[model samples]
Target: MADALTRDGIKYMIARLLENANEAVEESKENKDDAYCAGRKVAYYEMLDILKTELDIRDQDLKEFGLDIDLENKIA
Candidate 1:
């Protein structure tokens, strides 16, 4: 997809994904198959949004989480 996302766009998309995940969790409890899949996908996408935003922020502003960043390259 040539339409690669920008930071602002990713922010909006993440907000929407979080919203959808909230809805999906509720819906999944009452159905089978795709409902759970939809819920998990929403959660995954929302986390992606969070990581992207976090990375874009200046290091001075990032709150310390005590995470071992030296060991991994987290995917967005």
Candidate 2:
């Protein structure tokens, strides 16, 4: 079996997926297909939810490692 994904790996996957989704949206725009564009938008939101979950997991891991920094406030 393959190894399980770490937080960073999950993050990288999410970024790539989002990039693909963006490309799909652009293609749909050029082709003037509303259905395709709508599908891509749905996929984008689903990926966003997955990213949010991964971020929460990472935050938990950080706290476990005694690195309890407020990422939301600190990062931006």
Candidate 3:
């Protein structure tokens, strides 16, 4: 098993999980019949919730951790 994660590690995971969840959503849109896509979305979201709770993270904390994603390229 891996060692306990540092705060940065958790934040990094949070960012990656968010990205994966976003991808799952897009994939689900393309293939609504894919059960695996729905499962991935649920798993990623649950993991994110657990990690965020462990770190007591808020939306602002995500931004502070540089995890504020602009998946839609909305940020200029």
* Model 2 clashing residue pairs (backbone): none
Candidate 3's error at 63, in angstroms?
4.4
lDDT of 1 by residue, 1-76 (tens): 5887775585576556556655555565556477556557556555644564566464522223322232122211
| Per-candidate alpha-carbon RMSD to the true structure | 8.4, 7.7, 5.5
Best by lDDT: 3
Alpha-carbon TM-score of each model against the true structure: 0.39, 0.53, 0.62
Q: Show how many residue pairs clash in every candidate, following the order shown.
A: 0, 0, 0
Query: What local lDDT score does residue 71 receive in model 2, on the 0 to 100 scale?
Result: 26
RMSD of 2: 7.7
**lDDT (10s digit) by residue, model 2, range 1-76:** 9998886675566567656766766666677658767676566656555556565676655343322443233221
Residues 1-76 of candidate 3: C-alpha lDDT, one tens digit per residue = 9899787786676667777777877776788788887677667666665654544445446565544444333211
Best by TM-score: 3
User: Model 2 — which ten-residue stretch has the worst lDDT?
Assistant: 67-76
Residue 17's lDDT within candidate 2 is: 62
